[model samples]
Target: MNGTWLTVLMAVPLVGAAVLAVLPRRIDGNLAKQVALGVSLVTLVLGAVLAFSFEPGGGYQFTVEVDWISAFGAHFALGLDGIGLALVLMTVILAPVVILASWNDADPVDAAVAPGRSPRWSTHSFFAWVLALEGLAIGVFAATDVFLFYVLFEATLIPIYFLIGGFGGPERAKAALKFLIYSLAGGLIMLASVVGLYVVSADSSFGPTYLLSELQQVDIATDVGRWLFLGFFIAFAIKAPMFPVHTWLPDAAAQGTPGTSVLLVSILDKIGTFGMIRFCLTLFPEASEWATPVVVVLALISIVYGALMAIGQDNIPRLIAFTSVSHFGFIVLGIFVMNSYGGSGATLYMFNHGLSTAALFLVTGYLIKRRGSAQISDFGGVEKVAPILAGILLFAGLSSLGLPGLSPFVSEFLVIVGSWQYAIWVAVIAVTGIIWAALYILLMYQRTMTGPTRPEVAGMSDLKVREIVALAPVLVLILGLGLFPKPLLDVINPAVEDTLVFVDGASVEPVATAVDDATAEEGDN
Candidate 1:
């Protein structure tokens, strides 16, 4: 009964998973699909309720706090600020859509492994794990206690790692194992930092605590803070899948079924950037300032490196994977800019990128299912046959390219504009990535969606009614958020402003306040 109604929003998915576990083993595929759908619907409804109660003006409403471990001072703390609310809502939005998209599609891995295994359990297990994942993911955003946050944060990796490895394509095991090694290695490193933060606080009589709010108060020396922040940053960057460390993501995405890819890249990968905002900015302000140059430099490399690699991919899924590396570089850029515009813009981008990217993956998955291959050459004149699917792709593609009036455009604008005040040269270099975004995205669209139909694609059926339903919400959100983002920005701004406000650093006040005020103005739009 953590009054944190947000907890219920998170827990419904978990409860659904448990119910799914005991569902009659003999259930049909359609019934299994329906049950998962029901669970997602319930989670969505509960999420709406939690969202409804959110006071854009009322700070941290629907909060639930209780003692979970007294010794650790970790209350089962959870609540929503505007930014957290958006991510939570977006996560809920993605689950049902991904589920619906793949409802009738065969579990590629399942079909290969146990042809006799009921689709019901395969479907059942998939959704159950998804719900469990959704619950944990939302908890990561909502949890106010740092210890609880880390647990939820780290917990998310297991389900998705399995999702990709256990039920993905030919290289599933290798891709999954790579993902596990990278993520666990990052998490383990961050854990030491988490412990270091606590141990560093021990001299204050209360010792150190993992409560982010508490840790924020126990000032470490500037050098110690930088080292500590790197632990957190490196972990998140791997999650962000920023360059060099990002190699695992493409393989995972290409190997996993479309639904699994959507969850892994769309929602789960966001944990990295989200971690940057909540943990890094909140706990290690001095370190964040110090790391700005290096962070932005790496972001540029990801931007340039990822885009360049994307252009060379014949595998459609792998191309999308490369694009993500580039896009994530922007997300990381927005973060280290250390201003509200950059921070809030980065936050909103997390939601925008998820829907748009999910749309692309799901649509591509539909094509892959019909064609038996995920090659770019396997598609052509897709619009002639499936105008709706083609149209969703166009819109999503344009949004990813940062076309005006689309979601990514707004967020990227904010990030670049906000960063200009503090890091003008870096902002200039990052702008090149924006140009590359358009180039790669459009090139991809032209190659796959146009031209005469390939022999394999000519006879393909258009989207099924359920598939249309699956794609609809994402289309609506991409456009909706693009057209009328003010409400969301309003919620995101205050929290972002709070994020940029540093402790006891009043001498640098004027510039920060100016940046904060400007971000508020931008958010008002």
Candidate 2:
């Protein structure tokens, strides 16, 4: 097919979305749920087909390039590396999970409240948007050209913003607006940097630009590079919702449906760290080196600070949201570590964390539906009634805690080891966050799954056959990847090695010395 597979992959979901808008949203309440599941299933299957045909350790496979905006030199370019392949696969897996998590919900609230009754329980449009989003996200991860990447990147915001604002609780509008403002601002700011980069080309030709590889080859001064790096980093930071810029996340997550929250935290949030790896590390190595220690320190703060806040949250969704801040901190730390282990771990962690966190949020959505609340206090020892649900929740919780023989365990372990080579202190500090993760996750489990059952919850129903079917694939992955990480590791290693080029060529001692200086200054502060 000569890379035509990529186009078809994207087109399937997009075409499905085009068909979706014409259909009703809900059918007898339950119908909306079924259609959403069906749409997501078809998308997932196409993604699997792409994966099954994928060649592991391949640098950039199935590339398709076509001129899109010729005057500006933009190309409709797409390709996948081993890392992109893994993430694309993970996103597909979670697409259905998000739909299932949202299954019990009726039509998008706005559709119903707009002077007309929501079409009885079909939610065909909702599935269409969700699937369309999946297709675009795959496009983002697969894009080989800078222009195409940015287009797909910005496009992701639309569906998610509508999903949250249209269907979420009363605070939905504010949450959606805040998310939009933050993300859009970040993207716009980076656009300036992108233009600036093109302007600096020797030929002063924008026509030969807007290509990722072309941009990567352009060299600028350290200061200019630093400024460019900031444009990209700030956007990813807001997306990562790390530390100071993180306030919007908890609100958005708490208000959005559980499925929406899963997409927010698992796949979308990853765009931030992925930026660091692709744009920051690859495009601005000198700037990355200069900024490494500072970022590592902030990452450490996120680890500790996010955990503390997670402990304080009464809302389950907000707790998960804060946990992302901490998790991203680890991802950042690993990126800054810039070693084989750190780089590889961070990439692998993205895959594992996506699956684990998606399961957590999606299942929690089901809990919210049954209990009519997201308050931790409202869900007491429901295992008495919903044991199947409880078991799934426990598996997800353990994954969050980095339990051994699970995906999180291997990735986090690699991150710590990779960082250990650079600064033992960074690893030591990062490890404390692990303890906090165990605390909040286990506490959530204890509160929801153990002890004497409440009257309301004791009557709660367990997983239905459809729900069980929805959850099985993820559970199998949890155990399968945990027991056999080698297959995944082998694929990731080649890409990780390629990324280590700049880092390996560097004088490690100077970098370590700079890091030590940075740490000592932080300690004094």
Candidate 3:
């Protein structure tokens, strides 16, 4: 059973998806939501069981391998390290919450629209796609074979495409098409790298292999490795939606339902940064180091540029989307720094960002549903009408800005500290983004929640019980991790140390005493 847990974890939602696909038309949407929620909950429980049983320093647990393509050296290999386990837990935890958040979207809001443009989707089908996506996303995080990972990577786009196109705003078709084009292009580019990896391995005494462990051992020339690294990095960069390639995200998130946005931005986008750590750095260490200077500059640009764009946005969802770009910059910075502190911070940031971003999107969805608009100007004096909702919004917004007592603050500080170890100037520039963060988050809050009640919003209601239930888990995690991050850090630090060993085998120097001495000198003067 221990050996098979990962398979069962992936199988639950997939089986549930299949069940929902064949259910009779007479089956109600509420029933479908119930079934989906149940399956996701069971998966979450299974993930928890696995987590408790997991040894903190275990490299990769519950590994199950079987031959798929003997000639190509690909296998149906699945395992979980601390990093993968954390992400798998995130996906499962968010699945049921997303379903609950999207409960109202199961029905058509405006049935009078033309048949082809109708925004409504059958609840059963909608939940099915969501469940299938949950399964695929978990598989992506857990896959140990490069080919299997790429397969899951491309497969995830299908469910999300439908989730956006079928259930989103009027421009959903265009948004969906844009997402598909960008994602497919990236995946295709990565496929070239995958093939190159196989060729390189075949040329080696190790022979051809797509298993990540074996692939790591086969060495290619510096020039070829750099090219191969770019193939993978560009794909991940596009997926990470870093800077110029990030345009599609604002559109897709603004157009899609909140739950859809949560799945896309919060969980799915993580694959990009996650891959940069797991594959790019691990398999091509020298190339990773070679590319670090340019990559770090790009990350800095994303941090500053994303914050500026977010500050100017009038649409709530789009604003949130841009903020994510900035956050991802921080994550990328930590990873590329290639030190234990930076690496660990980036991994923890992945988990924390997912929780905080989901809360923002869902809370924004609630506000939009109540106000009947997504425009910032449409929301004024929201706190007066719905204080609890406003309070949640404030907490989430503050967390986004890295308030000292929140989960994001811990990870953000770790990233800065880690980046400083690698390069102080990079850390200093990245710190400026925090100022920009405060501007966007606080300004957005002031404009939307504090002004005189807009006439249209005067009669709006507060969050319902189900909505609170959806949010409670995230809020609890936000606070719990903020106050006591040691548990998760303990799990994450060992894995990050291992990754750093694989990437550069360099040790981090202690900077705390230097900082303390500087502070003491200033105080003495």
Candidate 4:
């Protein structure tokens, strides 16, 4: 049962999707939603069981492999390291929440009778895509073979493309096309690297292998390795949606339904940073080191630039999207810093950001559903009418801003502390983004929640039971992890230590002690 857990995790959602797709044409939207949510809940429970059963100090647990294409060395391989487990857990956790948040997003009656309605898309199909995406995302996180990973990575675009195009906002088509083009371009580039890796493997003593573990052992010359690294890194950076390639995210977030945006930003985009840690650093250590200088600069630019953009946005969904860009900068910085604190912090940041971002998106979506607007200017004094909703928004917003006693703060602090060891100036500059975060979050809160009640917002209702149920788990996690991160950190630190060893980077030192030792030696001299 333990050996098959990974397969079961990936299969359950897919099977549920199949069940939803084959259900009778007249099935209730509520029934479809219930089925989807139930499947997601089951997957979440399986994820929890996997986490508990996992051995903390072990490198990768529950690994299963069977040859799928013997000639190409591609196998149906799955495994979970501490980092992978965290991400898979996040994916499973968010699935039911997304289903609940979008419960009415695909109502058949609404589409049939609403003004200017298009009756083409079905509620069943929408739920099916959501479940399919959950399955594919699990596969992406659990895959141990590079070829298998790439396949799952690219396959994810399909369901999300439909989710954005079929069930999204007014500009859904344009946003979907942009997302597809950008993703396909990146995937194509990554495909070249994948093929190049195969070529390199064939030429080496370890011939024709795409297994990540085996590839990590095979050596390549510096010149070839650098090019291969770029091929892989560029794809990841775009998906990380870092700096220059990030323009698509705001547009996509604004156009998709909040649930769609949540999955896109929270779960799918994580593959980028996850790949950087699992593949780029582990496989091409020297190339990773060589790229650090440029990568770190871009990371700083993303941190400041994304925050500044987020601060200026009037659209709530787009604002949340830009904030993620800034947050991702911190994650990328931690990964590149190549020490235990930074690496573990970055991995943990991915998990924390997913919850925080999902909460923001879902709550804002609820607000939009009631207000019929996504613009910040259209909202004022919402707290008076929807205090519970406003409070949740404030909590999620503060978490996004890395407020103390929140999950993000711990990860953000660790990233800063770790980077300070790697380079003091980089850490110093990255710290400035925190100020920007406070500005954007507080400003958004003030304009939307604290101002005098608008004529339009006066009669708005607070969160219903369903909405509260949807958000409660994420909120608990944000607070729980913030107050005591030891459980997660215990699982993450060993993996971080192993990664640093592979990259030949140093372990974290106590910053205060290091400074004290230096000062004492200077005084003695």
Candidate 5:
């Protein structure tokens, strides 16, 4: 299991999806839902086994390598470093949550569709696509070969494309198309760099290798490396949907189902930052440092811009989407700051943000489904009628705002502290985004959950048992990890240190405040 763990972890879901795909269309939706749920649960268990089997300070455990495309020097290679493990955990955890939350999301009659539109696929197809996306996402995280990673990365677009287009609001088709175009545009741009890498490797003593380990060893001149870096960075930026290139997200989030939004924003978007740390920084360290000033500025802009947009959104799902944009900014900022605190925090942020955003999307999704509207204007004083639902929304909203005693705060603090070491002004400006976060999250909560009960929402039902079951784990993790993130940090810190060796020869320590140094000196005296 140790050697084959990653392969088994990835195969379970893909195989489950295939089985569901081949099942008769006349099969009951409940059965399909159960099968999907059961399969996802199994995957989650396998994920747990992988987690337990993982030796935390160790690098790249559960690795499997086999030659695939020898001409291009690609292989069916998979491995899990701590960074990849964190993401894989998030992916597996979110799979069943999304499946459960979306239980009725694709029902042609029972599920709510945007006015005048209907579900374009069966419930089974929706679940199957989700399973496929999960499997591909795991592949994306675990792939050690650059070409293998790229293939899995591009392959992810297919299931998600269908997930967005076939289900959710009336504009899903248009939203899905926009997502595909942006993603494909990015992928195509990265392909040039991929080819360049092959070209670079071909000329080297290694004689054509696409393995990340081997690529890191073959040093090209600074000019060629920077150009190659740009190709990959631009693709990741679009996927991260950073400022200027981020327009596709709100539309897709608003138009897609909550589960689709969760999978898209929470699990899928991590690929961007994951690639940044894994590919951009590791493979092109000098270029990364050279690119930092501009990248930091872009990250700052994304933070401010995304927050402001979220504050102004009338639509709930779109609002959540914009908040993710803001959060992704923090994650990206941490990555580029190039310190232990920033890198570790950024990696952890990928996991924490997934939990926070999934909670927000799913709980808000319940609201939309009940009210039959995603518009903020349609909901008021939901707490007056459904306190449980309102309470859960409040918890989710607070987590998004980086409220204390929640998971996001710890990671966000680390990023800010890390950024402060990089530049005081950058951290200050980044902090302002947290202010905007408060406004958007609190204002949305106030408007939708705390005002006088709207007549239409007066009889709104509270969260159902299944809804509670779905959200319970998310809320618990938010608070649990908030109070105690050491276990994760222990695993993540070593990986951060290792990654930093590429940029800085020595492990960069997390910078402490002046007061802390002074206090330590005083204690010593």
Candidate 6:
């Protein structure tokens, strides 16, 4: 049972999706949602069990490996390190919450559909896509075979494309198409690198193997390594959607339903930074170091640029989307800084951001559903009628901006502290993003939830029991992890330290300490 746990964890949701797909057409949407929720809940339990059974600082627990393509040496390999565990847990936790929050998003009743929205399928399809995505994402995170990882990574886009294109605002189709184009382009580029890895491995004395553990031992020329790194980096960047490649995000988030947006930004986007650590640094250490200067500058640009763009947005979802762009900058910054603090913080940030962002998107979705609009200007004094909704939104926003007591604050602090060790100027510049975060979050909150009650929201109702149930876990986790982040830190720190050791970027002595030592030596002389 322990041997098969990883495989079983990845299979459950997929099997549930298949069950939903083949069910009799006459079945109601409510039943379909219930099935999806049940599947996601089971996955959550499995994830928790995996967590409890895991040994802190253990390398790759619950691993599975089997040959799939013997000739090419590809294996159906999977493993979970601390970093992967954190993300896997987030994926499972959010899936049920999203399913519950999206309960009525694809209702069969025509009246429940928002204006200008034409769903391509019923609730069954929506829930199935979510389940399918969960299964594939789990596979992606756990895959230790580069070939397996690449396939699962590309496979994830299928469910997301439908989730965005099938049911959303008037621009859903266009947004979906844009997302598909960008993703396909990125995947195709990555395919070139995947092939190159095979070719490089074929030259190894032991012959070709796509297993990451084996491939990490096969060395290639520096130039070839750099080119291959570019191929993989480009794909992850597009997925990460950083800087110039980031245009697709705000549009997708704005057009998709809030549930879809949560999966897209919070869960799916982590693949980018995850790849940076898992592949770029671990597999191509020299290339990762060579590319660091450029990556850091881009991260800074993303930080300031994303924040500024977010502040300018009147559309609520788009505003949240841009904030993610800025937040991702911090994550990417932590990754390339080449130290334990930055790497661990970046990993923690991935988990914390998912909780905070999901809460924001879902709570805002409820508000938009009530008023039938997503424009900030269209909402005012929402707290007067729906205080629970307003209060939750405020809490989510504060978490987003990295308020001191919330989970995000800890991640941000670690990233900056790590950056300071890497370079003082880099840390100083990154700090400005926190200030920008305050502006965008507070401004959005003030304009939408704090003004005098508007006629449109005057009759708005407070959160329903179902909605509150959906958000309860997220809120609790946000507060819990914020206060006591030790458990996660313990798991994450070892993996981070190991990666830094692999990349030869482990933290060094502080400059202040070095200067003091030199001064003491001179005094002795």
Top candidate when judged by TM-score against the true structure: 5
Each model's TM-score, in the order given?
Answer: 0.92, 0.90, 0.95, 0.95, 0.97, 0.96
| C-alpha lDDT score of every prediction, in listed order | 0.80, 0.79, 0.89, 0.90, 0.92, 0.91
Q: What is the lDDT of residue 38 in candidate 5?
A: 96
- Give me the runs in candidate 5 sitting further than 4 Å from their true place: 110-114, 505-507, 510-525
Candidate 6: C-alpha lDDT: 0.91
Residue pairs in collision within model 6: none
Which tens-of-lDDT digit does each residue in 410-444 have in candidate 2?
A: 88888898779879999999999999999999898
Angstrom error of the Cα, residue 85, model 5: value is 0.3
> Where in model 4 is the C-alpha error above 4 Å?
108-120, 508-525
Summing lDDT over every window of 10 consecutive residues in candidate 6, give the lowest-scoring window. Answer: 505-514
Q: 291-329, model 5: which lDDT tens digit per residue?
A: 999999999999999999999999999899999999999
For each of the candidates, give the backbone clash count.
Answer: 2, 12, 0, 0, 0, 0
What would the TM-score be for candidate 4 when compared with the true structure? 0.95
Best by lDDT: 5
Backbone clashes in model 6: 0
CA shift of 17, model 1, Å: 0.7
Global local distance difference test of model 2: 0.79
lDDT of 4 by residue, 130-208 (tens): 9999999999989999999999999999989998888787678899999999999999999998998998999878678
Candidate 4: residue pairs that collide? none
List model 1 lDDT by residue over 126-197, tens digit each.
777777898899899888888888888889987887677656776778888998999999999999887777
**Comparing 1 and 4 on TM-score, the stronger one:** 4
